[model samples]
Target: MSDQEASQTSGVIKKFLYVNRRAPHGSNYAQEGLEVALIGAAFEQDVAMAYIDDGVFQLKTDQDTSEIGTKNFSPTYRALGDYDVKKIYVERESLEKRGLTQDDLMPLVYEDEDDDWEEKPMINLVTAAELQDIIEQSDVVLNF
Candidate 1:
């Protein structure tokens, strides 16, 4: 069904939070979580994603998986905005512990349809405390 049709049949719009705590490679948790988040967004749900622990590595730029024989799915993250999946949260402590900064991540942005199609960022670098509040506010939390 289309997003509008799904929304109409679902009644209440739920806030879905997909939490990622795994690295981008090695396993499928990160990729599977991303697919689920996009699916939720396609259903017209309020979907957001949080990256903690090694999950922060999923967004880090300049990733090369050639040696591992794994496809680099990092570029797919850039399409989250197209699915209307904004509100991506990255834990501050995770970045610090990894010695990485926002500059090391891909620049993900979305066009605000209600604001004359103005482009805006989707990534929100938040602290552990703020992330906790976000988790509490979510109606559904899926971890990977």
Candidate 2:
């Protein structure tokens, strides 16, 4: 095989969407969702995460899980970049209904190697309609 042919190949790349509608720390859903997302990224699939309802709290800054005797894993979302899972869609209405703005959330960013390590925001504040479209376009939709 030619060197170029050896370097280039195509495989089944599935689009995975993880829908998080539950509050973090209330149950294992958010944490487990993140775990699944990381696993999907490790498989080199196209993965996107959607935070709706109370799930928006998952990405909120200043979470004090210590009060409840559980370790806060909010920081793990930031590491999604290392795994190439960049798309994190936060439902705008969910945030507003919860009295949260984009500034209330953690700034999740990833270094784009192709862009000379330029930092890019991973959290996408999307509308309900937009989020619906995202879900419709995904090949595999996993709701938690």
Q: Best by lDDT, which number?
A: 1
lDDT of each: 0.91, 0.88
Please give the TM-score that candidate 2 achieves against the real structure.
0.90
Query: What does candidate 1's lDDT look like per residue over 39-127, in tens digits?
Result: 77757788889999999999999889999998898899999999998789999999999999999989999999999989899899999
lDDT for 80 in candidate 2 is 88
User: How many angstroms is residue 91 displaced in model 1 relative to the true structure, after the best TM-score fit?
Assistant: 0.5
Model 1: how far residue 64 lies from native, Å: 1.2
**Model 2 spans with C-alpha error above 4 angstroms:** 1-10
Residue 33 local lDDT, model 1: 86
RMSD versus native structure for model 1: 1.7
